[model samples]
Target: MSLDDKNTLAVEGGSPVRNTLLPYGHQCIDEDDIKAVVDVLRSDWLTTGPKVAEFEKRFAEMVGAKYAVAVNSGTAALHAAAFAAGIGPGDEVIATPMTFAASANCVLYCGGRPVFGDVEADTLLLDPSSVESKVSPKTKAIIAVDYAGQPCDYDALKKLSDEHGLILIADACHALGATYKNRKVGTLADMTVFSFHPVKHITTGEGGMVVTDNPDFAVRLCAFRNHGITADHRQREAEGSWFYEMAELGYNYRLPDINCALGLSQLKKLDKFVARRRQIAALYDSAFADMPALFSLAQRDDRKSSYHLYVVRLNLSKLNASRQQVFGALRAENIGVNVHYIPVYWHPYYNKLGYGKGLCPVAEKAYEEIVTLPLFPAMSDRDTGDVIKAVKKVLRVYAE
Candidate 1:
């Protein structure tokens, strides 16, 4: 199935990229990962145990952070960070719309307002200038997401936060292994969050962690994750006391020991996984160098991306087909392409809350042309080739 052999698109009548479907992202798990889980299953404590603390300790050390708080999910990590930062009624948090809803939803969960910031046109990251412009007196924090695994301009963001007396939180769900200015993603912001979903760089089944240098923030995060309780059962037993107090309102956001065991195993392969993703990204860059109708996201010289996604912006003006048509064509050919997101405010829930379109013009425009390609550490060369072929085929068919 060479391109020259086909005169039409797969949507019409031509050879498809592959006979099988390739999803956007997939986890890479090995025997070690399985054995770790099994070992935990045989332990007495499954949810809150020594394994959880061990995972946190290793993860914190891995990222050069003083502390790491493990939680049930990435969303919980965000919620805990925001809550610990004292985000409450009448406070505003600035966040980019070019991310998952949880980035901003965490603000709303804290009874605070989320002010949308536009992203840079080239990198598709939260622009510091845009964030500066959105800051008001009520602004309490900035939740900057490391979109598609590329770290944001932390120096500029830190300056802005300092100038405004605002908390800086990194929603680094996509950037566990990413780096900016020679520093790891976890140590860049006041508090950095990581997701361990199956699609992420590592897997804990369903888990997340928040790492930070501030001892106060770490203590607050721990209490917040455990129903605002001041002590764990282990602490109670050691002190010969059964009494525990709920100091503040909190949720059951604890990450189970079984999941942490899996995470610890996966952490051992983090560097390897990230290297493979970076290799795949480089291959895509080289493959698309000559393609005129597609422009990949700009890679900054100072930042090293984990490449959770390899997104390209389509030059729709040069193509005969609309984005929807191209997306459908790719899907029709078993190429599991997807849009990263609709601007957060574009969702009906946000709309009902008076967040309308045109809030962040750049994000809205980028959303229309962006296409997320398949990129994962587990992808075989054949899988990568299929993605490249499918994209080229779709572009050729839609070329004006």
Candidate 2:
């Protein structure tokens, strides 16, 4: 529960009074994940091999999905899902702006136009009412981001999507272990995507998975991940490799066996990781509960968060200083506080498409007050204390 200030800041151990440096988010790795990769390295296949299939099967079963397709990255999985879902030119895919650009960019990848839907004032997740306002004749899909590992109001969003005859793509990158109304997130959307980057709940170096119950979509996604060429032919070829025809144009987005092995290993510890994360979050929750001057996102009814990134909304009106100053002061204190996102439309790329201002005002306002706090399963109690202490210290100095 301690961090060494004089040495590398990887683990906890510091002076009696020296504050521990807390990171916003990071992955948890154990001997098991490493051993899994080592075992794979010594096996027969390396890339696009047996381990990949094994990982997909286990992961699909974990999330209660009929099938899962592993890809090189979350963005790739999104792109494949969009492509196979028939997102083409002039098609509109509604989403919230409070997420990373990848959520909307995936729509653009398949020549679909990304439409921004405002968020709920509290959760900062896609608002079903706002989403309804953006649906048009060309609307083909709705990609709802599970921001902060909390599932968006899927039941409402589902009704809207169903009414419009649009697909629902849950960018569940932040909600792998999250649940909505007692059901897992992966099974709630038409296509649920997950990320295994170093900063996520798990680590596969760089990997993502697309889960769906539709067999046809699974077949198309599998083909799309491997250059649209059927791997069934490769398995049958013995003497000489027979040429395979492209059922449709696709990309090489399949994840390597090494990454899949790492993911599979990490998946084994998924429950443990989530439990630890919740424990840490509970400590923070208790610490910040009495501080009403701050605005923390409240847990909702019938939902379980994965605690991917525990964000606290700064009550800018109560503080004597601006958000930038407070954020800067925290970083100077080595607290490593970060911002979750800057509304997707605020990015210049989206601006070029004439997605100008005055859209999703709620999300834009949340962006101004949002600050991501350190939350990782590997975080020690001392690390959590340091983050809490740093935050309180900065707020005390900045508060009127």
Task: Give candidate 2 misplaced runs (Cα > 4 Å).
Answer: 1-20, 232-234, 238-241
Give each model a TM-score.
0.98, 0.93
**Model 1 ranges off by over 4 Å:** 1-7
Go through the candidates in order and give the C-alpha RMSD of each one to the true structure: 1.6, 4.4
Maximum-TM-score candidate: 1
lDDT of 1 by residue, 139-193 (tens): 9999999999999999999999998899999999999999998999999999999
lDDT of 2 by residue, 1-400 (tens): 3354432222122332234456788778888888989988999878888888899999999999999999999999899999879999989999889988999999888888899999988888888999999899989999999998988889998999888898999999999899999999899989999998888888799999999999989998999987888764347565367767788889989898999999988988899898888898889889998875576887788789998889999998788888888787777667888998999998897888898877888988888898998888888898888888777767766778
Steric collisions counted per model: 0, 6
CA displacement after TM-score superposition, residue 25 of candidate 1 (Å): 0.4
